[model samples]
Target: MTLSPAVDAWAEEEPGAATDRSGWPGGIPSRVVRPRAVIEVQQLLAEAYRTRTPVIPRGAGSGLAAGAVGVEGAILLDLSALDRILELDADEQLARVEPGVITADLDAAASAHGLMYAPDPGSVGISTIGGNIATNAGGLRGAKYGVTRDHVLALDVVLADGSLVRVGRDTIKGVTGYDLVSLFTGSEGTLGVVVGATVRLIPRPARTATAAAYFADIATAARAVTAITRSGVRPAVLEILDGRTLAAIDDLEGTALRERGDALVVIQTDGYGAEEELEVLTSAIAALATDVQTATDAAASDALLFARRRALPALEALGRVLIEDIAVPRKRLAEAVDGISDIAQEEGVDIFVFGHAGDGNLHPIIVTERGAADDPVPDAAASAAERIFALALELGGTITAEHGVGRLKKEWALRELGPEVHALQWRLKEAFDSRGILNPGSSL
Candidate 1:
């Protein structure tokens, strides 16, 4: 396929070349297109559509799954160059930003005006707002504020035919048409490429408190998460780490969990100087924990929270990581944890588990030694990964809770969604992308 002259001049044709390595899983894309503006993206997309080339729309590439990993002949549209907070409406509590604006940057900007974006993925520091919107990412705050889809008010998307279409309304509430915004949020670029977005923001909390609790077993810790949910006390962030994950974190941070407990539950709550709200949450946590430690100040609380957010990256350094986002009923969290443990043991793989326990979304990362890459072990890892996903399905849970069905999970997506739903998804894809050129092999 012949690329446009301008696109050819701007695109990087080197295989496995990426500006940032942290975001990509297996490696970088085969070709990278760094478009400075939406029109440039339009030109590139037009060429790709005409040539029938697979195009992978990439933001920060900080996704846990290999969502941004490019195929042999695919083009990686790196949107990082489009980073811009185009507009901020304080009165409306909404912000319009280009695809490449870093998630944390927007949050910091909003916070300066006494507002905050709620959907914060662990990689918020570097993950782009477009990526967050595409994946409908959920972080620690999800328990209280909900996922990316909840805050996204509107989106400006580039269709498969190089046409631009705006979906949803900037207003607080509107039911004028189909909820296409919701459809694209977690579509993983299969339906269309997001060029820009309008996200809702909430007032910045005046005060916040953090507490960490230790449990003798993972089951106890899982129960504590359920207890918090059952109690109707919503925390801004709630996280749990298994013994293996704790060890990985200690190795990375050069610190211990004080109690060396089998499991640890970290909870944070925020509001308008609601110390009493925090107190009640901490008290309930203490009831289910062997040892509870509450942070007295913001700095200390942030430190603890940082550790939880860094768990995935820290564990990844030890080995090749396969991150799984599986979620089940809150009350059945223990069963899910036990089932994962059983799978890990049966597969003879070292698995580290951690995630937003408040919402029952657990990320089980399978870490294999770097040496495993040279032998048949990678195959073993792949097989074990499949089994883990199947286990989640068997438990009546989703194979993916927040991380969307990227390339790695596409096969299982069909299994999870079934034939009827899968066919309908295909129909939707055809409607939006008749040529089947936009982000092939993703989601549907």
Candidate 2:
């Protein structure tokens, strides 16, 4: 394939050298294209499609799945420069934003208008809105407001042929065509590149409260999470951190929690003047907790909630982390947590478990020392992750609840979806990208 001079010239203008390597597992792309405008993105995609060259759409590169990893000969389409808030319709509670806007930046901007974009991925500070849309990311707030797909009202996508198509509607009601917006939300760049999005926002809650509870065993905490759901109390966020995870965080952040408890649950409730509502919910959660402590104010509550957000980074400090995202029926959370512990024991690997307990989504992080990628432990960790994923399937859960099936989980995705559904997904991919040059080997 001949590289167009225009493409080469555009690559030269990128901020960093095209071949700059990342500490991430896969190496960087041979060329990086940072388009300053949507039209430039279209031109880049057109060139790549014409030449049948691989192109990986990257946001902040904060993704754990290595979905942003570039192929050896691929072009890295860095969309971070397209950061712009095109519009904010306060009356409609929706905001139109460029793909490269940081997740936290959107949230902050929304908050200024007394509204919020609910999905709060851990890397919100650095992860781009486009990445969240690509993966249909979920977070602590997902229990209350749902994931990225739930809030997305519309999307402006650039297809494989460099043609732009708008999907979904800004209005609340519309059934004009297939739910392409939802379909592309979690396509992980295989279907198309998201250039901009109109996302729904909710009014900022007037009051908030949080409670921390300790359990003697992880299963006991898992049961409490089930109880909270059964009680019909929707928390803003419900998180669980096992002893190992707490210890890891303590070691990294100098905040001790493992010593005080074997398992921890952090629950928060927020809404319009939700103090009373939160207190009621806390009372119900306290009934299922061993040592329950409720925070009187938002400041204290945020401090407690910070532990969940810091869990992954804390584990990363210990060594390499193979983070797994598994979700099961909310009622079967205990079984899922127990299954993880069983896998850890059988594999004899150090694993830290934590995540959004409210949605039954658990992140079991397998940690091995840096530079130990070839060690037996890393292999054991991978085996453990596979076991945990299989267990989630057996329990009628999903292999990936939030994180997309990047190259790392592609093989397992076949197992999770079965042959029929998998083939159908491929057909859909072909329909959208006939030449199959878009983020090949990712998702379906």
Candidate 3:
């Protein structure tokens, strides 16, 4: 089980090996291989497959899910070294990128060509494109722009047998075969390693506007979100935050959020219809708000949107947070939120709620004591998370709107997928990786 000096040098369990942002200090790997080229990946996988070694493909490791945590005696594929933008076809509005390219970096590059990558996950700043595709991550703007899967056109995958195979079509409208692009996109590396990808880009919005609608109650704020959605006003982004989250945000920036309201809705309108759409949504929201204020200028708009984006970070200040990505019908968001709040009380956990209300995706971040992550008060946090998932399911919502079913949520995934479909998923896993060498303990 000896690797070449260069291979070992490139990916040894040395001092340079970085721990991911996930903060899950789990198992130590037999080897951490950073492939410089596709051939290197092919060679590594070929040997691993022959030896029946476990391999886990990893990117920037911004994932909170334990999906990429290396198994003992496994080979951890560090894809960050493969970062590259192979091609950007502005005319076709497509970008060919290596797996390790940072998500936000691709968006920035696309913006330069008058195009923009659609998915804007919270960790876009450092998360990899391959990781996003692996999770099909949703963003604040997912209500309108959709998730990472919607933009993925094709993929270059390295299979367990060390074969470099291409799945999916480069064109936008291709249904010639099974949709492997979509299939593999959210497979979370259990099936294969995504070496490269062709991603679709949309035209950048011509203009953008934002408004903050404040409500005395969370139900009213959610009702405003539903009304805005039903009013034919397609806001680029619509977010709602509970009073606790709003108060924390004010403390973070000295904003008057706590003084203004207990709950707030932040809406952003974009494209050529930016102003017109905002006008309609704002009017609708005002009818139900204790006070509604549209950002009078672009600076103010940016501030409002920035505040909404800061929800997760502000919550982190209180304690270690287990952020939940659950989504229900937009009409049922307030009910779901209320039930989530009840769970916090029942479980004796501090829960701050916020998310894209337009699409019904909510983040119920469970906060616990800082150092408690190792072993303190696990019951309360665990119970809160479980109840949140159960409540989401009862409300006809998914346990995870965007986050993949990693090691953390595998149990819930089993409950959600059921036996028949779960068995089919296992067949798919077997079809691509019969030996179970690729991402063992991931996906199915």
Candidate 4:
């Protein structure tokens, strides 16, 4: 097939730094394409589509699930080179950016104008806006500001056939067409390639307050989470760490958190209305927690939040970990925690649990000793994860809350959706990519 010299210039044989943090099972791509412009991306896709070569859109390589893991002889479309903030209109409270723009970089730019981009995944420092949109990511602030879908105003997508289509609106409200923006937000690159997005931003809050609430046990802490949201206290950040997680923090070099309590709940209230919000949160939490320690300053709040920030890394220090992101109804969080602990005990697996408790989203890490390179995930570890997935579904919860259903959880996701619904999703996929060239074998 004939191609533009510019598109051919984008090819590289080696994956380079793009594969550094990915869980891409060593499936080497035939070529990695790093297009710098939308037209180049279109040309590359057009050739790949005509050639019937599989293509996987990739950004940052920070994804935990193997969503970016490619099939043999595939073309990995590396978007990082396309990073550019095309426009930022403070008056419109809107920003137009290419797919490769880092999430935190955009937020920092927005902050200069007293505006904020809200869908912050834990890996916001390195995760890309395109990846966030693909996953519909959520974070600590998600309890109030919502996820990526909430902030995305519109998207410019490249379909499998190399046609570019713009969907959604810049205005906050519009019923002009079918909600294609929502349809592609969490599609995981299957339906189309998201090349650009117009995102909504919110005004920055003026004042804020924080508190670290201590609970006798996880169930009590979990119960307070249910109460805080229902009590009309909209906390900007509400995180929880169980006893095991606290122990990990204690073991972390230069940290002293275990002495505080077996279960810890960190809360932050922001905005001009923060004073009243802080009072409501503290009062509601004080009723349940053994003691509620309010932060006297931002430093204190940071100290309180430090343990949560280090939870996953601290667990990773022990060994390899498969983090699970399952969320149940807020009322059932205590039960979910208990059920997860029970699974760990039965499976002989070491599991550390913690997450954004305000929304009942939990990240239960299944810890195991590190194995040799190229070794598949251990059978015992895989079985334990399956059990956890089963428990979440039994409790009327989703298998994934913020994380997309990548290669790791695709089978379980199919089980969760059942046959008819799963088939319907495929029909949509077929309508978009009839040859199944886009990120095949990922979330349906």
lDDT of each: 0.80, 0.83, 0.85, 0.84
lDDT of 2 by residue, 299-357 (tens): 89878887887888898898877788889998898898888888989999988889898
Considering lDDT, which of the candidate structures 1 and 4 is the better prediction for this target? 4
Clashing pairs counted in every model: 0, 0, 0, 0
Candidates in order, TM-scores: namely 0.93, 0.93, 0.95, 0.95
Q: How would you encode candidate 1's per-residue C-alpha lDDT over 146-209 as one tens digit per residue? A: 9999999899999877888899999989999899999999888888889999999899988888
lDDT digits (tens) for residues 1-444 of candidate 3 = 434456554234443333344445546778788777888888889999999999989888888677787677888888888899999999999999999999999999999999999898889898999899888888878878988989999999999999999988778898887889999988999999999999999999888878888898898888888899888878878889999999888888778786888899988889888888888888877778887777646788888887787888888887788878889999998899889888988888899999888789998988888883335437888888888999988999888888787777888988888898899999999999999998887666
Q: List the residue pairs that clash in candidate 1.
A: none
Sort by lDDT, best first: what order?
3, 4, 2, 1
Off by over 4 Å in 3: 1-25
lDDT of 3: 0.85
